[model samples]
Target: MAVVSLEGLSKRYGNHLAVDDVSFDVGDREVMGLLGPNGSGKTTILRTLTGYLRPTAGIVRVAGFDVVQEGRLARRRIGYVPEDAPLYPQMRVNEFLAFMGRLRGLDGQKLDVSLGLARKRLGLEDVGETIIGRLSRGYRQRVCLAQAVLHEPDLLVLDEPTNGLDPRQIIEFRTLIRSLAEHCAIVVSSHILAEIARLADRVAILLDGRLLAVRQVKASGSIRLRARTDLAPGIVSALRTAMAGVEIAEAPQAGGMVSLHVSTAEDGAVDQVIARLAAAGIGIVEMSEAGADLEETFLAVTSRKAFH
Candidate 1:
């Protein structure tokens, strides 16, 4: 069963349709990435899911509880970390978590256990008694995540979770996200294509308050081919013949090696292209699935005009 479900969900303000008929589900152990430009209704959709705003139309359920009708119950099953997580600068890490736990109706040993587990999972052991204002930006983000998961919610929602973190912090944040996904469903919203590609199992693209496409990100489809010889007419012809809709372009040469950027619209094109090259004896020095980068894919999806 889906831990989080939204069917025909729409939210409007006056004449503007901020979210139009947005619908999707997040199951156990799934990380759903929400992608869109500014004013695309990603934050509005997330707020609706968390029961902070009543949708203008459509149904939303979290852990089988209706967000509109049973908001209190529904909210208990969700963990939300907004772009700017409000933190009390005066409070210590453990003190703040304890306060949040009590608000969630946790007390006594249960609250202690929850706080302990959250600290360990989020690598906050050293900062338990540290003041919130004194922690670094990365540690602050970790605290936000720790508080979100403290209640053991069934679904976790994060908006631009890595916005200001450094490179190393971003990597550590990604690790924490992956670790959190082991027990609950996660919905992350980000404009950074690389972050979504690295952290999410599936990506849902939103454009003008409408869902454009949901893509299954895999490692084997992005093919980068390098040539031992110059990208000659013969090599280009062989590639075009072997793979339809393959995009090939010249790349910077390294160590006197000719390089070509090859992109395929379909999977398994790499194998066929490699075989055809060998038959015609076109030197293929290196060919591998390119590392995870979804910038091109995001542009391809979002560039299309949305239907009225």
Candidate 2:
């Protein structure tokens, strides 16, 4: 069974349907990215998942417990960090983490161990004594994460986890989240496709309060090709007609080598693509397997339908 599951989830604000029949699941050890533009139901989904807002229809479950009916159990298994990661400005970093840990029912030796682990895991030891208001944005974000994971929840949910982070800090935070996957399932909500590509094992695209598609993070059965000569317009057209639904794009290349990225929705189409290219008189000088990038897929999915 999935550790986190949303079945036919929907929410409404008076006349507005904020989320519409959204459904997806995140298994143990999986990192699922929830992607959508602003007001596209991504925030609504997260809020519903965390039990902050009740669903107008359908159900949300965490660790097999229904979020609404078993709110305490479900919430206990989830650690959440919102987009802004609000923190107490006057409290010291260690103090705040300790306060959060105790609030979650940890105490004595166990609380100490949890605090120690959070400090080391998030690299907060150096800034433990620093006040929250004085810490850099990156360190403050880390503190927020530390508090979220202090109780060692079975699932972690982060909304725009790297929103205000510098490039280096973003990289570090991504690495930290990936490491956390070894211990629990994670759901990251973001509008940044590239960051989602880096952190998520799978991606769920949402648009206008509806789910568009769910895609695996790693591409399978895709191929990259290099040819000595540029593909003629006629050959390109012929290849497109011969292998319908196969996506082929000319990639930028240096040293005059023409590169083509090819992927097909149908099974066993790699050979068919190669044959079509050869039949079209385009010589395949090199061939290698490649992953389908999320950026292109994201654009294609979101652009499919116009949204207000």
Candidate 2 lDDT score relative to the true structure: 0.85
lDDT tens readout by residue for model 2, 2-101? 9999999999999999999988999999999998888889988999999999999999999999999999999999999999898999999989999999
lDDT of 1 by residue, 54-142 (tens): 99999999999999999999999998999998788889999999998898899999999999999999999999999999999999888
Q: Per-residue error at 43 for model 1, in Å?
A: 0.3
Worst 10 residues of 2 by lDDT: 266-275
TM-score of 2: 0.76
